[model samples]
Target: MRARPDSLFNLKKVLMNQPVSRSVSSQQQAAAPQSPQSPHAAGASGSPPRTFGSGHPPRIAIVSASWHADLVGQCRDAAVKGLEAAGPCHITHIHVPGAFETPLHALKLARSGQFDAVLACALVVDGGIYRHDFVAQAVIDGLMRAQMDTGVPVFSAVLTPLAFHEHAVHHQFFHEHLVHKGTELAAACVATLTSLRQIEALSS
Candidate 1:
């Protein structure tokens, strides 16, 4: 598939106003203060403990697909909340036209050496095109390749459902589900980065 310059250009426009440190709204900032002692810092109860070995905060890049803007936004917002609640961290959020475009952007960010971790979020549903499976698999494979090529630790929250209809019921259910997935993604990111940091320290 050819690259969509227009979509990428629009993404650049969105990123202009979003600083690299954090892309959260004022409401989220107010809701999640920078506190290391928060109970949710270790992630949902019973999850593995999260430890930040470095003095500086971890820098994360979140690349989200905008096909389902409303649902995707819910996930993004929840992720921001989870990340902030985890502890102080730098986050950069970017948007792409759709899931197909996320891999390239994610790979670019991972190669830049500016972020500790990279994440891709999208809701790829079967549109009766019969190519949803292919697209989803391609996206996931691309993300994995990006991580391996750059060694920057890439994570995916991309969800591909077998059936998704344009109705209030499905929409509501998926919206709520994406929010939960987003939070889980954030927790996983924290845990992974912490473990990598410890391993690096030991190696050094």
Candidate 2:
């Protein structure tokens, strides 16, 4: 695919005021705040440990951008391989214009209730300006919002590099890096969904 000159600066104007929260543990704590007057503390009931069941396969959706499809596709391929290896499931791939648009599509998919989880992957790079940071933050934040609103688990493999140039060496390195990232994301997806199931089982 021919590289677009303006692609690097494409999402600079979009999602300039959003922030990506990278602290998962902190978010969890905040989500479940403890009250001093409560009769039972968090985890008061010692429930039996539950394992991620393999009987029900999860449905997953992967949304990727078309701008850097060549490199971005590598991430998707790795994600699929990893997910399949982790547990057999129904996986779907969706294509969008760019990273800035991934969240909306992910929201739609999550809301449709057709999938157990959604994963967004992209390569947002600085193009001689501070816009890349904004775009990346917005996309990630948007994904989180979608997850919270829909009660669905969403994963992100979006990366923003401080130094990115149109060079053969850089391209080769990031391509390999994305492969590892994809595997990590897949593992996270499976683990998270399994945990959610276990939590649901607690009430049942």
Candidate 3:
């Protein structure tokens, strides 16, 4: 599943060729005076980050599993709201039958070069008929492989709970939890993209 050397080189070239907005370039210059290794350089110095997609709205793709429609829907909604709040973005959502199908959809989207990032959302629970752990592991591995092979960033909101039951109380707890996780995923997605942009700027 490793990417060919030439493909990696092409990915690096594409990143370098991406346009940098004037505002982002200015922000990067402002932060240049700070210590290179400082963790708080961006925040403590009051300098804005060189965020990705500053030149244009980023294209994002989301793949969600529909097994537990009610629960998964909450996560998807929360994630969408969070991304919109962050900034302008073009989001495409696709639904699959279950968690096992999400990785394939994500891979296809990532390889298409149409999205800056991909998000996968699902709730993997023990159904008492098969090993949920194996399925979860495979899904995660596939997602990692997709990103690595295609040089695209992939974010996962796939959760595997040890004990889950069809009860009102359990549902309420998970509903709230998924919302929190979704929000966190949105933040991570933005932060990761911003960091990558900063790295690209530094290299250039």
Candidate 4:
């Protein structure tokens, strides 16, 4: 795979900062604004307990759901951006017809022993049916199963919007959020992977 020149240096920087959960906790602490009622209160913070990012750059597969191609594409981009932020990763993309199908495709890739991480991105929206919920659950469950059964790390940014309407505000808001999610999730993935490798080394 060709190394993306612009992203390599920065990604290495992120990898060097491999979290002890300290930076993430600190970030959370800073994010909490002082309550008007109480100027200073003891604050609490945490990140996803899972450390997905870390170690050498990873070879990853990003799967996007096609039901909303435009929206899901943002996820794909965000993921790539995230991976770049973490380090120079080798990335490949797979487009599935909808969120429900992403897990299967990801499963195939994960089981192939070709990629270190698999990321599935999608937007499951309610269209006056129970289908979105069903698909969301199934896909998530399947991804988990694949990882557990294969020891392959699977990361998801597939979200079910609470109140997504065919309106401009919702679209714009979610799009912006998706970009952030992609970057953040990518960071999380790297952090988790690094931490896991760290523990594995310690145990050995």
Q: Top model by TM-score, which number?
A: 1
> What does candidate 2 score on TM?
0.73
Model 3 segments beyond 4 Å from truth? 1-53
Candidate 1 C-alpha lDDT tens digits along 76-161: 88888888887889999999999999999999999999999998999888887678889999999999999999999999988887
Off-target runs (Cα >4 Å) in candidate 1 are: 1-47, 50-54
TM-score of each: 0.76, 0.73, 0.75, 0.71
Better of 1 and 2 by lDDT: 1
Query: What are the C-alpha RMSDs, in order, of all predicted structures?
Result: 15.2, 11.4, 16.0, 13.1
For model 2, residues 42-93, the per-residue Cα lDDT tens digits are 4655322222356588899999988788888888899898888775688999
Pick by lDDT: which candidate is best? 1
After superposition, the stretches of candidate 2 with alpha carbons farther than 4 Å from their true spots are 1-52
Q: Which of the two, 3 or 4, has more lDDT?
A: 3
Number of the candidate with higher TM-score, 1 or 2: 1
lDDT of 3 by residue, 120-194 (tens): 999898899999889999999999999999988999999887678778766876787788878877877877777
Candidate 4 residue runs with Cα over 4 Å from true position: 1-56
Query: How many clashing residue pairs are found in candidate 2?
Result: 0
